[model samples]
Target: MSEREVLELLRENARYGTDDIARITGLDEDDVEATIAALEEAGVVRGYQAVVDWDELEDERVRAVVELNVTLDRETGYADIASRLARFPEVTALRLVSGDYDFDMEVEGDSIREVSRFVSEKVAPVPEITQTVTHYVMTAYKENGIEFGDGDEDDRLSYSP
Candidate 1:
């Protein structure tokens, strides 16, 4: 429970030092440090990353969500294909998901043409991949449980069914 609480705090802000975490969680500073170390060793805490609002940057990379349907290989399976896809520097994230597609992929490039080329040249050529539908990310309002942009005023309408 304590570990979960610590993780939640870290998720909110990865920059939280031991003293801050200890203060927030009401745990001793030394214990907080030890717990974090243990979590990292256990791979419970994979990595700390800064969530940047790429739209704010003048030179932002083009992003897209690609839905891919695949025919799974008997011997190799998902692990091998997923590994192959992940090696590409353009691939931001990939997941084997349930629904219309076998894989949900996030990729980035300098332009839409670059991403298209990657799909045509790199991804589609794989024997297992049958079809791919790409959806370009126009804007990211929220990600990783954190809302993007400054204004917090709720714009959602309330209704009863």
Candidate 2:
């Protein structure tokens, strides 16, 4: 199969095995395996991941994204700060980016107070983190692997239940 075809298969489901891809793409299983291996070696295919709906689980949890704007100080290590934040199980994602915020973090906790404590006691204390903004998600119209599919892909869409 061509690169475009392989990409489409990956887009459909990244975790699909080479045999499955071969069946779908009408290519030899070895070719499919080679293509995937090449994609991985070239750093095009990073890895396979499973998407989980944590909210559906019988656990009391809240998810929030905390945006941090930091003054880049030469002394305090940014990685150290990130590592410190990750010590708590609540922190799920920590990313540094070029924008108004230095870091965008996704966190989950058993309760609102627990989440708040993580922000105050853990996150807020990181030096150079001059500003921290916390947004508690009331409802995510779309998130993670969840996409709202309407017939018109170009149309502005809203999710209503």
Candidate 3:
């Protein structure tokens, strides 16, 4: 079985069983299982995640994209700050990028005030951080493989279960 094919299939749906993958990829079920095990050992397949449409829930999630400008600590580079911020439960994702900002951060909270407090108290306090800009997400139309409300009259759920 080709590892890339297995990886791609898993990326589309993490719940795919070895038998299903074997059927689709035209590979032996045992081989598909072995490849997945090997990839997991190598840390190539990080983990599985479910993309739920939070809008339908009674408890809404507030997400924000935070842009940070930072002065590199010559000794520590970006690792120090990156790992530090990554440890926070509110930080869903963090990346060092090239653009107007040095770091792109995704954070979420139960409420806007909670997210705001996290940014002001947790993110901005780092000494190397020079500036921060936060943009709140108003709505999410599509996430992962699911699409939010398209407002169709047809009898299809807006998102896949």
Q: Best by lDDT, which number? A: 3
lDDT (10s digit) by residue, model 2, range 1-161: 36668877886788788888888889998888888778889988777676655555787668899998777567677787788777778888899888777889999987889998889888788777788899987655555555534334655457656
Better of 2 and 3 by TM-score: 3
lDDT of each: 0.91, 0.78, 0.93
lDDT (Cα, tens digit) per residue for candidate 1, span 5-29: 8988999899988899999989999
lDDT string, candidate 3, 30-130, tens digits: 99999999999999998888898888889989999999999985676798989999999999999999988999999999999999999999999999999
**Model 3 segments more than 4 A misplaced:** 150-161
The local distance difference test score of model 2 is: 0.78
The clash tally of candidate 3 reads 0
Residue 43 local lDDT, model 3: 100
What value of lDDT does candidate 3 attain over all alpha carbons? 0.93
User: By descending TM-score, how would the candidates be arranged?
Assistant: 1, 3, 2
After superposition on all CA atoms, what RMSD does each candidate show versus the true structure?
A: 5.8, 6.7, 4.6
Per lDDT, what order, best first?
A: 3, 1, 2
